[model samples]
Target: MSKKSRPGSRSRALVAATAVVVTLLTGAVGAGAAPATTAQRARPTVILVHGALTDASVWRHEVEALQRKGYAVLAPAMPLRGLASDSAYLAAFLKTVSGPIVLAGHSYAGAVITRAAEGDPRVRALVYVTAFQPDTGETAGELNARFPGSRLGPDTTVVLEHPGGSELYLRQQDFRDVYAGDLSPSTAALMAATQRPVETAALGEPLQGRPAWRDTPSWALVATKDNSLPVATQRFMTARAHSRTTEVASSHAAPVSHPAEVTGLLLDAIRGTAY
Candidate 1:
């Protein structure tokens, strides 16, 4: 991975706190019975949350892909290693938008968006691009640890962690073979090489408050071939969140390798919500 010098440790920690806010600990009712939207409204603000080991740039393909579809996109930078920081930063960013926002996240970021959406009226919908959707008080680790499946993530480095939990970075094979296997050699190499280090502890902690997916009008794009989060685990979370769902036959990094399909789904999300 491209070793871009990460932000200063102190600045990153403060930013982390800023990104985290009051969390909701309950699950809201599913948005299954709402009336269909009728009017053509302002373009919805699309928020893109990226997975572990990646920075905002991972959504480059997605942000551009959605822009061409006539939507205003907000691909905020997230601290992959901090939960409260990532969630709080995202929540604060959502407050600045004017109208409906369609929140989207990939991989572990799915957990971030799930926490960021509580009681925020600006969010009109949610889209999980092969992301995680843990319930209130459920940590990403506990969520990912559910019996039926396993995480397709890689092993931790000894220098990073000594005994137990350490951020498990993705291997080239995970990205090139199972996640974004369909991408060209050149593009895949760039993405793989540019992967970032994540906060190992973020995976083990449960959400502090109510989960946003319970009541939000959410949609899920399941990359069936995803080995990173375990395809079954993705399905498990999607089902629990009770979201409108679509299937993409790619791997974990569908947003990068399958931008066309990923953005196409985003277009459908906009039209479905009338914003």
Candidate 2:
């Protein structure tokens, strides 16, 4: 009987070579394929604007905290002149940022941001910290006058015909008691000495457009023990603006005295706007 036909050594070698070539060809195709490009992550920029009688320094703690958490934070020095001019200035500044923004305002800045953010689709959220949330045709002064508990009237000093309009300052003697009751006396003194004055006209300027909060999501921090802007007044304004609100037992300088709480509120705003 003829020997059973079997694969010859040459045929076996050819089969092995083909398998190696196939494996190498498969690997080469995979290696040459383009890697999936990860979509660039988007993060909203946070802009913190200070109110009357204070500069951007007030947001130091908040800035530090937010930065540590990987947020892009900016505390712009707002020209605390008349509302129209300041809002225009801020609006111009806003135009320079490339992405969505979470705008935060303290005291008079709330009104400024309200005006600045109007008609701007990039502002995703508004945060009012012991701030004035004025409606159209309403002034910060009007909002402050709506309630009677504020102790700021007597503590303020006015200078007419100053450079940027009628300037207003907090009396150094009353700064601690009226604006920063929860802060250390030394720190409060330094704050009083370095506080930036606001033009009186800014407080009286009536808002020209519907507040951004009317259409944007909003968060408000009510300083319960505030002596500058009455807590009740803060509540009323926030309620009118339909803001998500939280109250802390703090003075008007809540951002300075209870920074953690203030920072917490701001982070909440950031999270609310994130997809």
Candidate 3:
């Protein structure tokens, strides 16, 4: 070589080259990561909370439908122990999720979310699918009796007592007429046999805090033929909440019997809450 390079100069040259490569790679990664993050923030997560006498399985159709549409959905199992405790549990669960949420509750799950979503800014909207939307100091039992035609009563439910508290299940014989009138008898029978029992105290437990529907935008599905919660009661509750409402001639088990309708209403809520 005409001029031999110094070791120091050679080392510096190598480091400079490495820095340039790293900068280029970092810039490429940053560019790719930005869009992914934006997409995640753009869509709100849909959290479906099932009510008493059922579990997350009730949202099977909805979960699949929404997933096919590229939406993130979760149907968490409600404790169904009592209003205060169940709401507390849901509120805790909500804290673990990131970004925004569109919370939907069915039947008694409505009251759960009504209290669970309180003061949570992440909950952008509330969807009540033939569910209770009890205000502060209101109980589910009280709301059920606010209107006539609810077939759910002592006659239709079987009570079981335990050390903790009593639980109630829809009698297998009356389950079809009371809960899943729109579903086939076979399907209703399976539901009846597999239905979960709810703590009887949950019905009388009042919603302790401010209902989320009071502040959040709300959508409701009024099952006109609902035997567990009458159509008139659904209308009254949704009206009080000033909810954007849809009416379907389904039973209390709208998600099971009218899955498409339930999915459509949930999509409306998702689109509505999207930023």
Q: State which candidate has the highest TM-score.
A: 3
lDDT of each: 0.75, 0.88, 0.93
Query: Between the candidate structures 1 and 3, which one is better when assessed by TM-score?
Result: 3
So what's the TM-score on candidate 3? 0.86
Please, what are the lDDT tens digits per residue for candidate 3 over residues 1-275? 59999999999999999999999999999999999889766888899999999889999999999999988898888888999999999999999898899999999999999999999999999999999999889999999998899998889999999999899999999999999998999999999998989999999998887789999999999999999998999999999999999999999999999999999999898888754
TM-score of model 2 (CA atoms): 0.84
- In order of TM-score, best first, we have 3, 2, 1
Give TM-scores for every candidate, taking all chains together and pairing residue i with residue i: 0.77, 0.84, 0.86
Give one digit per residue, the lDDT tens place, for model 1 in 10-85: 6888777665632221212123223233223667888888888777887787788777767688887787766777
When summed lDDT is taken over every stretch of 10 residues in candidate 3, the lowest stretch is 266-275
lDDT of 3: 0.93
- Winner by lDDT between candidate 2 and candidate 1: 2
**Which 10 residues in a row give candidate 1 its minimum summed lDDT?**
22-31
**lDDT (Cα, tens digit) per residue for candidate 2, span 1-275:** 87765679779889999999999999887776633211123678999999888899999999999999999999999888799999999999999997789999999999999999998998989999999888889998888888887777843664657554578888989898889999999999999999898888788889997779899999999999988899889988888888999999999888899999999998898888852
CA deviation > 4 Å runs, candidate 1: 1-40, 147-167, 172-175
In model 2, which residue pairs have backbone atoms overlapping below 3 Å? none
